[model samples]
Target: MDTMRERFASVTSRLLDEDPRLAVVLADIGVDGFAAAARRHPDRVVNVGIREQLLIGVGGGLALTGLRPIMHTFASFLVERPFEQVKLDFGHQGVGGVLVSAGASYDWPSGGFTHMAPGDVALLDTLDDWTVHVPGHPDEAEALLRHAAAAGDDRVYVRLSVQTNSAPRAVDGARFSRLREGRRGVVVAVGPLLDNVLAATEGMDVTVLYATTVRPFDGAALRAATGLADAADVVLVEPYLAGTSTRFANDALADRPHRVLGLGVGRRELRRYGQLDEHLAAHGLDPRGLRERIAGFLTSAARA
Candidate 1:
């Protein structure tokens, strides 16, 4: 499968060539992927080695100067480390830019917790007027990147995860697209967790909703799906922090009382690190773990 980072570099290169307004700022991560783009558009592709704060500040400056800047780096550094820069440089300045981050929650487990950022989305939620896109596949990443670049002064954040699905699906809007129909409940899968979510709910009687753009939480589509399916149980499976979207879901379903199970990376730090699979299993994000959790939740809901 084509990785999301590669697709980001390729699409960004095209954006640089075609749109003079688009610029990319890098922080020594995935710089090689954009080497050719940097060489061609030297002035547009700016690389500030190891300085996450400067990286975002430069992007904000570029945006202020009537140019669309795209910032790239690991999630940990991109959001968590330079949070003040994000809040002040971009948010305070009222300059919109696209901040694209690679490496999902625990994509680099060998690098330990310092390299992992499960609270990125939650942190972004603190700010206003920012659009977040979590694409499940490379194709979706390319599409979202292009859309965000052309959005005209919209502050967008595109999170690219290392894990991907087998193939790409159409993502034209922020609404949830129904993948499977069931009567028991609805399981909304976010980003790269789609395949695992499918496996976990394979034999279960539940409606599966896929979401690539999670931030603007498509309450209308979710409400319509749940209303049509008459499901009061909702299980939001995200790739980031657990219960990250629980509040949004609650607001979406405020018209009716419902049960929700939010699943994702846990808050506790797992000091032990080896492979990505190990970290995923430890967090109950693997296929088997997800299946067990989903089944237990639904079974308990049934009894209730």
Candidate 2:
């Protein structure tokens, strides 16, 4: 199976052919993939060189002219470097566009900290009305990408990662899918970590919720899952920064007594350039590490 990034290039190339209103803006990151698309729609497919801010600015400009622009780049360059442009160009201007990011957290560790973006989702959370999609499989990524491209004046962010699950779930780009039922607690796995989460929680009596679209979080599903329990013990296992969605979970269960444990990439930088698997294990995101943490959290919660 192709990686999400490769699927993105192919799916987007087809989108450009199908939708004339759709435009793609890049910063020389994935220009090679869109070579044919560029040739076909030179006026619509634009690469603004290495200027990250200009990439967003051009997308915003395109949005103003009644075109839905899809901006692409490394996550760090796309969200962190041009954050001000993202806030002003899209949010402040009240225009809509899709911001698609690759190089999730530590996809290319040799590229160093400059390429990783574990905080992209957390940073975007500070803004209002931005829909965030973290697809775990290439199929899901294609579906979400199509949804975002046609969102029509609504701000959207599609987070593409090198990591993916063994199989794709039926994701509608909204709501959480309840994969298991249990009265003890709920384990919400977000993008690329579902397989590990499943392995970690095997034989455990905990509800497993799969989330691809995190913003506009599926509070209703969370509530329903935990409503039957004596106390809600929620564990959020994300691929990005730890505790990124803790606040959202808290708000979702604000009316009741509940506990939430947020797990993901730690704040401390791992300076050593290692393989992706090593990075995941170091962050306690692998199946073995996750089992220890999740088991401990639930066991302790049971005693409480």
Candidate 3:
């Protein structure tokens, strides 16, 4: 199976060949992957080396010159490290660009906390007009990237992670698409968590909704699906930090008193370096762990 990173390189190369206005800016990451693209379009594909700050600055400059800049790097460096650049260079300057991030959350646990960015989306939420796309698989990633590139500088953030669902669904980024129908509760699977969420809710009387886009939150779609039932149990299974969407969920269900569960990576650092599955187990993000927590939560909701 192709990874999100692989799809990204392929799409970016195609964009470079198709759109003369498209320029790719890299901060010493994924440079070798696009060597052919860089060779073909010398003026379009640029590697700025380890300076993420300048990496963003160059993108901002390219945007000013009427070029659509696609910036790539690790999530930590792309979003957190050069946040000021992101804020001012793109936001303050009124220039739009696509910011694609790899090593989502703790995808690079071997690299430790410095390379991780669990709070990237939370940080982006503080800004305006940023479309966050969290695709669950390589196909979804490719589709979302194409959407962003065609969107024309609407301040897009494409988050890529090592975790992936078994396959891609016919996901439309406009709203949350309901995958399963039930009555007891609703489970919103954001990005890569679809597989885990489906496994957790198997044989249960709960609805499942899949989302490739999270920033818009799709409150209207959520309300329509759940009917805004009072005290309805709604669980949000995200790949990033737990409770990140608690506020959004509260806002969506503000009309009624509902029980919400936000399951994902814990806020505290795991500290130990290991494989991705080890980290998932440590955070209780595996299928079994998610099923246990979700099942228990549903039981309690029913009792209440």
lDDT of each: 0.90, 0.95, 0.89
The C-alpha local distance difference test score for the whole of candidate 1 amounts to 0.90
Candidate 3 collision pairs = none
The estimated TM-scores of all candidates read 0.97, 0.99, 0.97
Please give the distance, in angstroms, between residue 62's alpha carbon in candidate 1 and its true position after superposition.
0.5
Worst 10 residues of 2 by lDDT: 222-231
Off by over 4 Å in 3: 228-231
**Candidate 2 lDDT tens digits, 72-105:** 9999999999999999999999999999999999
- Model 1 lDDT tens row, 58-121: 9999999999999999999999999999999989999899999987798988888888999999
In Å, residue 133's CA in model 2 sits off its true spot by 0.2
Model 3 scores worst on lDDT over the 10 consecutive residues at 223-232
- Worst ten in a row by lDDT for model 1: 222-231
Candidate 2: give the clashing pairs: none
**True-structure Cα RMSD, model 1:** 1.1
lDDT score, residue 156, model 2? Answer: 97
